[model samples]
Target: MAKKKSGKQPIIGICALCKKESTLEESHIVPKFVFRYLNAHSFTGRIRTVAEPNRPLQDGKKLHLLCSDCEDLFNKDETLFSNKVFHPFKKNGFDGPVIYNGDWLNRFITSVNWRVLHQDLQKITTEQDNDKPLTPEILNTLSNAENVMRSYLLKERLNLDVLENHIILFNEEIMRELFSHPHAIIQGSAFGTPVIMNKDAMYVISNLVGILVITIIKKHPEEIWLNSFVSNESGEIPQSQHFDSPIVTELRKFEDFRQAYIEGISKNQLEKLQEKIRKDPDGFKNSETYKRIMMDRKLK
Candidate 1:
């Protein structure tokens, strides 16, 4: 009785939240320690990519797309939400709104809406020159919002009588305007979309830590403005609300943060972001969030 070493052959496919063909595992739509805490002050801590941002960015962007038992059930609700609410909201900088436990905020919003609906169906099957066609009604509203976030992450349960056509909303006031600007310029665009407006939502938008996470498959009236971060009747996400809107003023553009750092990267990383924007073109052209997006694009 001495012959037991049958490991490594688990790579079949189809387990995007127990759909069940089996064995997958390379997940991570937005949980590589939230891009290692948004590239912990990146000069080169990597992690940038609004398509490409001068290449060299990688804290995590995996996507064989889940099955190590659904990536160990979304790494146990992303390690109970990065050790209790994103490391105490980044060690207490955004200074307010932090009360949760609606079963750990519905298993951390069902593992961030099942990793932004499988990273928007793996960016429409790997961006084939993006004509963006993943549509059979956006794949049946992301497969019924991934079976209601996999029955609230494997049965913690919340069908709440058809959970209002599957609702979900979260916002952090662009993480309190990126902790009230600490010498701004942290644009590591990890995207996720599905918005079909007049109702049919799904927005993951965490350009590392500026959190958004919307979901609402089809039921509008802006979901009663996320009814105070829903989850009551003793579930508890009671207080914590600052997500004013207008998409946080288009994520405070500096020409969409220098076109998310010179789009799709590599012309030697767009000449190192055009030589760091020509050695700090006037400290990134005087940022009052780049003079209010150049006076709102010169009054449009």
Candidate 2:
């Protein structure tokens, strides 16, 4: 493991990835580049939390989770993802379907999944007056998934049994539409919050980059035709697919979120909403139902 020069000794704790007692480093749940894009477009270049838009958070949301060795392992994949997939999409923009290396895509998905689980674990352990406790079953599942992903990242494993049956969707139009608004940029609307569903699946919605990585922890549902794309060994993504029911549903969700941030919340209402979110952060962030009536209303 590469060591960094610092005055203070490394903080000793169980690394999230390796599960070994070691010095844990502060790791960003969402990659730093994502925050950089959000801040660069904002007037003040500061990120505001969705729960509390008034409160600005620096360095995005990070926690002391992984040790240096594990952190370095993720960094390697993060660099490949940023260079090959993320940067290219951001620069030239995707006009049609693009093919990605299966190995790299798998690593990217695993890395995001691991981070999401780590963040959730941190919240479950640290938050006050928590409504929900992290169940042993869920913790075990996440830990097992993390171990499989760590092996895959280190080239100790090849198959992605824990992360297989995945569907990655992209819609450049939604991203362009959201980033057009200055308020949306300031609120970090492009960086969609990660939502873990039922301990069976997770969604890492990156509206900024126009990508959605949906991981199936268990068997893929028959109703979801998108699974057909990944059912085979080949990793070719279509240039465009018909806006099926799922696609429409997801796009509408993004639209609702896009409009919500573009239409700023009032100071008084924001305070109340913040309080509600504080009480139930996961519920508030993960709500799928969008009230169309709220579109007409604005903060005073």
Candidate 3:
């Protein structure tokens, strides 16, 4: 048996494809919508999808991770190496921000693991090969490859879809500038509410950042500290879930969250609302729901 390499030298285990973490978007190891059923309100007390590294979405969080490239290229069966991809260095060690993540050469070399890596390759090639079923011998070969390399899952493999509706890319600007091999943090908007660093929907950015974290790191100054923040911004969608939905026990009143939403509403209306709040804190404070939120915030 080959000895497994273990170290704390910042080598990316989760992120293995890209070099630039900045360019590398937060790839979800698991889908976010799945959490909706499990946790709809306040992250169910698990990672709340803050887009910031340290903050958890709500409470109980469960998700498998996926990088951007893996999600985009393979999830959709898109072809890699077809277009010119960027790299920080050709083969030598570098001083500036590297392009892709984690010893790409080494990753490819180490990816000889048959079960995980080979299966992906087979699944992908199978599509092109008329969806041919794997031969018993080949299937057997792919069944056991854990020993070869724990990090052997390749970006471009065959039929590699974990669950449908998987996300590929969450961000791009940072990915191209940073190496995706190291642990990273990303921020974006999902469904509606702001997210700073995300791991629930990263597949399109490429499997660059080994450790991808997404959250709505920064938003309007009024909606800071998060617990008061709402993940859903869509109001037109039927508002049926109760304040005490099983997924979220601590649901903020809809009225309290109105200012935070401006996507679908008119700008003039939003400005008027904002002006009202700014001009008359007392009037805003007098609202029954706002009073309740304040009381909760004080207690929480």
lDDT of each: 0.54, 0.55, 0.28
Best by TM-score: 2
User: lDDT tens digits, residues 1-300, model 3?
Assistant: 998788533323443343234233334323333233223322112333323323435432221223455545333211111111212111121223212222332232122112124335434445634554545544343333322233334433432223111111222332223322111122112221111122222111112212121121112223212111111111111111111111111112222233223234456645666786788777666553244345434432
TM-score of each: 0.30, 0.64, 0.19
Question: Model 2, 1-300: lDDT tens per residue?
Answer: 888886977689998777799989988877877777656554344666545555655557677888999888888767876776666765565555556654666676667766775566556657733566556776677666656666766677876664553444444333333333322332234443434444554433343334555444543243353432442233656655322223334444544555664366568756766687688766544441111122212221
- TM-score order, best first, reads 2, 1, 3
lDDT of 1 by residue, 1-300 (tens): 998788776678787666778768777777788777656544445655555555566566677766787678667767876786667655563355545554555565556656776666666666733464556666666666666667677664655333322122223333334333312433223454445432354333344353344544554444344333445223433244444433344445534655556555667766775687688777556533354345434433
Span of ten consecutive residues with least summed lDDT in model 3: 241-250
lDDT of 1 at 258: 57
Better of 1 and 3 by TM-score: 1
Each candidate's number of clashing pairs is 0, 2, 93
Error of 1 at 6 (Å): 29
Candidate 1 TM-score to native: 0.30
